[model samples]
Target chain A: MFSLLLQSFVCCRFLSSLWLSQHSVVCLLLQVLLTHITISNSQHNTPNPTMMKSIVARAYSPFCSVFATEDCDKLANDLGYEDLITLLAPHGDSVGRATVRDSQGMTNTYDDFAIRLGAKRPTERDSGGMLFNPDAMEALLREYIGHYNSDDSAFARFFAKLVAAPPDTAFETFSQPAAHLFCVSSRNAHPLDTLQALAQGQKRDKDCLNFYVLVHDARVEDAENSTQRTIALLERAKKRFGLAGMIKLGQEGVPETIPTPQFLTVGDELVNLKTGVGFGSRTLSQPDKESIRSLLREFTVQHLIPHMERCIMTWDTVAAGKRGLTGRMFSAGKKWLKFGGSEKQEAGSSIQASGIYPQGSPEQTIRRLADYAFMLRDYRYAYATYELVKRDFLSDKAWKYLAACQEQAAVALLMYTTRLTEKQRVEVLNPLLDSACYTYISRLQLPQYALRMLVVTSDLQCLLGPDAASQGATQWFQKLLDERLVGRLGYALIMLRVSYAFSQSPKGRKAALWQLLSAREWADANQKGEMAKCLDMTAPVYDELNWPNNEGTLLTRLKGELANEAKPTSVAS
Target chain B: MSYYLAIVGTEDNPIYTQEFGTYRQGGDGNSRFSPEMKELAPFILHAAIDMVEQTASRTNQLYLRTVDNFYSHLVSAFVTAGDIKIMLLHETRNEESIRQFFQEVHDLYVKTLLSPFYFVNQPITSPVFDQRIKSLAKKYL
Candidate 1:
């Protein structure tokens, strides 16, 4: 067959380069000849290439959940390397190349392709179910690479298969509809007030956050229930706020499932909420209020806009930002892809790459998937999706959006994901890299985001090392501390987080205690008795949240502060 | 314009300290610092070490000219091949003259290190070394 001639020519030319003993050279060359014959013979024996292509394409597409492996198969099966080039040309994304010089001063050329699947989000006026999923195309690329090759050939094929896919979104490949988020609770309930405050606070969003308050239906089973007073209080409160459509579980108007337990369903979080809503217009600590405001403002920007923009997205390469590789690159998906018109002569139309996707392909599906993840409280998935798009868009607005995503991702890591493996914790669950990116906020001239990032580092374990500080947490803390615009109590809270991040070991715990005491000092300096009183409450709450290895001294101090509320004096002094 | 010159060793400890004033515009070569300014001059110079350490890793320049500013005062630094640091805190803005003074000081430092009794990062207490730095300050400030 043709492979026999290929084996002979390749061996004769590469024989000297192989640098084998005289006897082994002939032996290796014969082995190569035999292997080629076996492979070519099997391929020739298989009938019907037409049925094979469809089967291969169907198996490689995003919808296919199963993977089949052949131990000794070639890396590029029915889909060779050149077929990938053809895939890009049809979509009109620019096919180009760039040559980079390594540290050794040698230049090597690379196929640099930049693509955007769902960048143009619909404006805020109209957000609907018709969303474009960005990961659909990335999933295709991963599938083609993962399925085509034998295990040993993977190392050789990985570079060619490299695609900035969002983490394996193939599981929910059929774009599902958004689930409604509604709350059910009784009136005069502290948790009800919090949900009401949250609903009123975020009304401007107008998209998503269906924040329904459902007072429990009264006179259950012919007046056997004495829960009538709580219902009446809630009903009066609801009428005062002009809220209609109160829902009860299994009632006609209510959603089958209630999301966000903090809003609905009475909980322990409400026990402390009797004092007040955490965020409001009347708070004297203006900085804490402003910090919370900034957090909410960013939340609206991320949650609302993407929800609306899902309708206007384009899968074609024409919609991609023509600009790439402009600023300090915080992530991948950028390169000087095209030099001039002469690029076609080099790669022949074969290995050419583009950011374009064919119109019917899954790549243009909903970016709303990320927004959905965030709203669903699946921060890990939200982090993955945001990282996918934010790398492509580093504009001032998008970068700030990325900052919000990072902060939320960090919060998700600390609150959840403790039970995962160390490798899983570091890679999928933790936002340590996002913390590194948080320092870039200063470059964007948003100091509030920098302050938020410092607070975020409280969740990062000390084992993550000093790079977390050098990246910007410590430097920004020093900068903000010196400037002192952040409130005294808020500053104390941030310091608490930073000190906690550094206190995974018992030896470091002593130093962390001094930091906690200093937070109380700052609270006292601000002259806010409520903040000073509430400062110690963090330890017991954090303990209940199952955060690891907290110092016992912090709890004792908090309990003492709560017990001494009548006198309000320093426990030791 | 005034100058506060310091020679910092590899361990970030100060090996030398001297104060000088503008010799240009018919000014006398004496420090015009108030009692408070004289004390704060050292603090300003030390605060700039972080800035020096930051900028040093970015470039190979021997004279890291005017890397940090504290209020009205500006700080400049020079890093030697021996990893020693020479810092200058002043109100002046002439980079060329400062570079010239740094090159001369670097030569003098080389000559001082040639002595057998001296150890690296040891306090540079020789009166002759002090006199040479003062002359450079007169020529540059």
Candidate 2:
């Protein structure tokens, strides 16, 4: 989900190779699934499990749902508010900087900071607290994306929903938006009225940032006219909605009005959804690009960052106040164990029998705080906060929450720590990933999540450098194979990667053997090009080696298969 | 118990291969592998050779127990001197007895190697060697 140009140095280096390799597979699978999409409008039905898996995997980015009043929504119907943000975010030359106070009360700055935006269409108003249903929401999204399955019978539909949704509580918690962008289009006649109604209607909450953007169209009106209109709207907004009061409370910030020449540009493909709605893409001039970038930079710097900083402070204080002195001491003691502690000894913090951490409870607050810190790119603080909540989730026997915390904790460490020392790798990252992977795969039976976790962790490990790191990576790749988590193409791709990981390590013969295995898998998958490439890669090691006759025959037959592939395509036997 | 045993030479060449069944606990000794499993067994064992070599390098022990598994079938291995591996693909795990069986096979393998007519990496065609292995499976596996 990361924009290649805007990603942090560490993230770019860590993700580039893995992302490149996975890009083809993910796209190919999506293409295959999209072809199967049936756009029938039948009665309510549960999503297909495999279809849900693919959809869930695609929605891994941090979501920021865009909201607007009816008039603004109608005005920008061609280019939805969310789609506008998505299109502009990647094309910008720079999004500038943000300096925020982390959970540990340390200030950190990120240059060229950007959010990996997803086009999360606005839904009904979130009932103002922690009980957002990610499955229902994602199901809605799946429907929007044309993955709705109408063939499922009513009872089967009910049972499928019952089985699939509840166990994946981690994903539910993650689907909580980092921020919500409310828009008041310049085209709307009563912009001030719409803004006031949206501001008042949106329940003022401390959990997520709710910032406003005045979407101006330069093609309709000049920038000076729109800016004058925006100022007038803000003046009226201050008096009507008491925006100045919200700004003082750190709950809101100054509104931004951004202009675009046109939503659609030349040579852009029109995206047709299941609803038969088509959204246009735009080409931007340099000034338009700069204004869009400036808008984001201003929003992130002035509103989102400050909002998160204030919330972290608020949540930390609330959690600390609830915890009291002895609880603080107990948490400090627990922190000692967090560094190098074994899994068995982490059962110290106990929760009551009810098992639910209420919306504003210290545990829930800290969890939200962690999520915010992660979204804000304050990884160190996020890591610490996640580690803190993990114990509470563990003691409460909340497998989904615990697994999500562990997964985030590992990711935070990878992102924040400049260099991953062997000690940290063994003590911290390994156990976190292992426990998370176990919970996701075994307890939740969410192999898709487990696959994602291992793939990301292994790639991060490989990026940390060769030797022990690459060896660790190879081991994780082997786990993917052992678990049989991927399809045939995925299996072949993983084998090819494992070979590369081995080659990165000092194990030459093992590397060559893995190349051979990869070639064989590719052949099985009927990917003759990849099969030929893998065979060629292993040739240096196996071609003239004094090995047995069988290996020799394997190479010969693989070459024969490639030769046959050239003659005419036959089914892989 | 169904078993597929292969002795792999240093260069990953199979020197000897056999498929047999347990003659213990009122059971007759007859290989019970399904047709698909029989065809897949070679690939499984061959794949485990990578694990065997990797594990063999890490430990000084002759018996590298249960190096890898595919489905319900477990691949237990024993490494002899000169990097040759004795691998057994079987269902269910009886670790101590498997170790004892492997040690006995190691003895037979060594004895076979000591014979003047035999050489390393050559397929074992001796009827006597096959008879001894079946008897060993009957006693221990």
Candidate 3:
């Protein structure tokens, strides 16, 4: 305390000796300072002050406030924050921040909230546009200070807080996901303007990182009304975009580690399984969907899953009689989407119609949730969800999407599962991967896509993985020809694979020609028709310089066959 | 010859490290270190810091040739003007090639320091620098 007094004494000497201000105002300010010190000594007994030293410097931030506006003018009556900013703007792209040191040492640091308030006279004078004098300005400040001291005690308190606050603090923040909490502030405005501009400017930067917008507005009075208005505006945006603000609970309900999923919009149409209600008002654009997908991936990783784990722990403790079951049983037990239920009304469950989950049937919701699990690299969860959903989607009609899901599940398990033993391959993985191939060809009619998945995913990793996918999977492609299920494209695909396989061998030449003959025989009585497809396939892709000599010669023969077939097609058309 | 190269900052924190074996023979550029030697490599380099400080204080020469040794492991030191110490632990010794390797790395270091994203006295995470150090070890070490 004595040291602080001595430091202030030295600063007072520096204030008078160094500062280029008028004499009378300095004397007045000194008197005000002395009274402030006496009041501070009597009113509070504290050690850690974060008080200003002899050096007067300020740090710039994205949310830094100058407090210069019509409202600010009415409060302090000059160009606000100009003097303080001019006095203390530091040198670096990286500015200093303020740390909120509680009795517990360092609890928080408002790096973006170190607001500097200032007031200065306009450069131009009203009387004949004459140059202003420093003496008159000093008198105006003196009168303003006196007025501030008498009627508006709140304004004086704000000023006192501003003066006592430290300039810049170091930057050390939690590395949360991009879509957690977005902070917005004005470039050059008062606290009121900064608050409004931050909200307004944030709507323009279109970043998908954070969902919640936190505004640091100046509130001298009617604080409740200001907060209500802010929330109302956010609520309106939420309704428009099918956004949901997670139901906020009191201190005990909300965990400190996981950030609250606030003001998040459902970028895609989502449905409820329990209530059977489709809930989406608007569709996000393509790029918006991409960004939202990334944000969803990050948020599920950062916040949602952690919160889910906490809830699960609560459930576990309740089961063990360590804690009673909470009245709210979260969305875990709630069937997220209803596939066939049409009786349940929209208003039955508040959560079911909220559009927080992705829009689909129960199966789709499971698939999407599994995908999110896959994206977060929780393969076990994904595999479990996929296993459950795959049973319901075994019908031939849902082959396309179901096959896609099955493939994703296989890949996810391949990456992270220690459960997949070599014994398990014959019993489990082979049948699953075989079905993934069979469904695509026989049911979905997209043979090439199925064949590629077989070739690329399973066969290449033969050395490391089981031989079941490698040796057994090739029969699916051959079966397309054997069962007479293949079209022009499928035949071409098989031949191409055969040629690619033998391209390096001494018998590569015979194999290519023999495969061509085998393709024709598989066409049965329609060898001519199959031959035309083979010609059509190679003609479009034929390039003299790009193709190898042996493939070139075979392609040349196909060109001849194509020309002969085209002559008749011209007559028919 | 197997070599372990480490770039240590003024505060004795590691900035970058790489291990490589000789490409002179028909050997692949994989460090043929025994399990114990691989574990002891970092400690052997660290133990040479006292010798480095003693030599650094006495002479203005940045290059301190064959400063310290532990059994078969020979440690060489190169100190920059800014006090960034670069040390290399090798089973076989060659002075001229070591100086050339240090010079090339120093150039890369200067360029790396010029990057605005880099903070002072931090661990080097640049993959390009890692690659360069490995290639330099393969070439000279």
Candidate 4:
């Protein structure tokens, strides 16, 4: 109702102006808009430096699995693998220093090569479980890539949304952990036996690097005893697991290390939103921090980086073999034969039967290869791999898999390429994102994924030298509203986003109009704060047009409602 | 098909208005617009003027096909030299016929403007003009 009134009012104002006068106004508006554009362009109009840095930091981090037996919890006084890892883990800048050569043979030193340590490896349980779902992945990706909250440009927010992974049933964006840490407490009587048992339980892919961690509590146990036991356990693990034989470790450098857990008191029920940790910041002793740091650094430099480098080399060759002309023909022939052999097998079964690609298949290998390249920050290679595999998924009609590939492919390109030409944006990012969002919403019944997709895509778009892309971003936001995919609060929020998008566009009045509409939406959603904010933003525009009295009643009523909301005792009849 | 046509002058005053149903396919030449739509169609055309003006700036073509829409009702427009807008609020899109209708109406409008008694922004109350419009609606609508 408010929008209808506002629209008519705006239309009437527009209608009253003669074409000659309006044309002159449009020309003046364009000149002012062009001046603003020139100023922004002169300021090195790339994405925010911090945002790019954070995206690189997040995307390049390797994943590792920390496996602790149930006995480790008993030793740590009910502190499970998560708490123990948290206490002994080196996070962010504390991960010490590591020097490694990438697959491209460029030597780079990282003082903070951090690995995201998950408690367990990806299992069938995680596939069906609520944890680590597509929405969760999208949220986590947004956090890592950089939050879009501070960006004023609507395209920046949209780009952030576009480049993040779409919700997929198969969790493949973050690669399967390349390094597995088997952690055992010294208090456990048969630590070696538990390590052996746990190691045996794993499907022990040959490429994965296994590290044995002996965790001891400084407050409870003797550090020397734990170190000696760790040495003995390493010898046993070397004999039983054959990790030493596999990697050909030198006698001077043992894979096993003792990390003494330092106690820190943190309030329960408090979480660090940024890190998504169970507890907030707790200061650690400098030496303890250094010890954990050096341990992780050694783990990354000696085992993790080298292993990843080797894997990339091997996968590159294998991918070249498979994706090359002959390999493509061979695969095409194989697929054709399969198509002829199974006349009754519908395309849907390919997705339903193998929720993920069948193990050891070319698609799985390529995806794994892409994941590793992404982890290694070889984004070009990762983007190419994603592009290569996207077609296979498309032909198989694996919509979810195809969408995931498309999302990752776009993200990889966005992360690596600093600037995209108009042609690339239209040809590459646009179609990839459109298909991904469409498939997520239509093929799959995951509107949440579509929302995330649009949100991320808009953020990524904002990064690419803001221009008419904001208009495209606004259209996507409008689509979210039109589809009714968002809740009332989300609707109000996205409407404000649309307003912001328009505000960044050349047309100032359209921005004011959207702001008015957004204010109405906020009022409808009963969000007094946001409604007041939007009204405040639109105030100057209305004042310019002398429309205060025309909108005064609605604004006064809304302000009154806000005042009532602020008070404690406002009961409605 | 139901259509509501309005001839709005440069100052956005309604100079002429008509409503009619399709005369083809066994239909009587009477408007079948819903009572709610009958009340709303004028406002719809009024609201669409903003869109018409915006579209007019982007293109040189006088016939701005379907400038705006309110749900299923599309507003097609034709602009004259003096900035008089002839807007049609219609249910179905008949681009060529509407373009032809707008062209013939433009001729009639020019003839009306050329009259010594007629003036710009003056309402058309001539019965002969009304009869010609009804006949045109029957011939091509």
Candidates' chain B TM-scores in the order shown: 0.95, 0.96, 0.94, 0.98
Worst 10 residues of 4 chain A by lDDT: A261-270
3 or 4: which has the higher DockQ?
Answer: 4
Report the lDDT tens digits of candidate 2 across residue range A88-168. 435322355667676556777655454434334333222211222333423333332233233432222222222221111
Which stretch of 10 consecutive residues in model 3 chain A shows the poorest summed lDDT? A169-178
What is candidate 4's lDDT per residue for B1-141, written digit by digit as tens? 888989988755778889998899888989998865765565567556766788899999999998876557899999998899999998888899999999999999999999999999998999999999888888878
Question: How accurate locally, in lDDT, is each candidate?
Answer: 0.42, 0.60, 0.43, 0.63
- Chain A TM-score by candidate, in order: 0.31, 0.65, 0.29, 0.70
TM-score of each: 0.35, 0.64, 0.25, 0.65
Q: Using lDDT, give the best candidate's number.
A: 4
- The per-candidate count of clashes, in order, stands at 10, 0, 16, 22
Alpha-carbon runs more than 4 Å astray in model 2: A1-63, A69-112, A116-173, A220-282, A321-325, A328-357, A394-400, A410-505, A508-566, A569-573, B25-30, B34-59, B104-139
Q: Is candidate 2 or candidate 3 better by lDDT?
A: 2
The lDDT ranking, best first, is 4, 2, 3, 1
Report per-candidate DockQ.
0.03, 0.21, 0.01, 0.12
Better of 1 and 3 by DockQ: 1
Q: Which is the better candidate, 1 or 3, if ranked by lDDT?
A: 3
Runs of candidate 1 exceeding 4 Å displacement? A1-371, A375-468, A474-484, A487-573, B10-12, B25-75, B79-83, B90-95, B110-128
Residues A1-573 of candidate 1 have per-residue lDDT tens digits of: 344567676776587566756777677677777785455222211122222222211111111011111210111122221221111111211112323232233544433211111111222221111111223322332332234332222111211111111122221221222212223344223635555564554324222333233334332453334255545655665565443233222122221211111111012112213333311112112332232233223322343223423422332121233223432241222233433674532211111133222222322232344444443334454455555544333322333334544544554454333344456545753444345344444434444444434433332322244443222334344444554524444445445434443232212322233244444554455433333433432332223222112233343444455456645465545
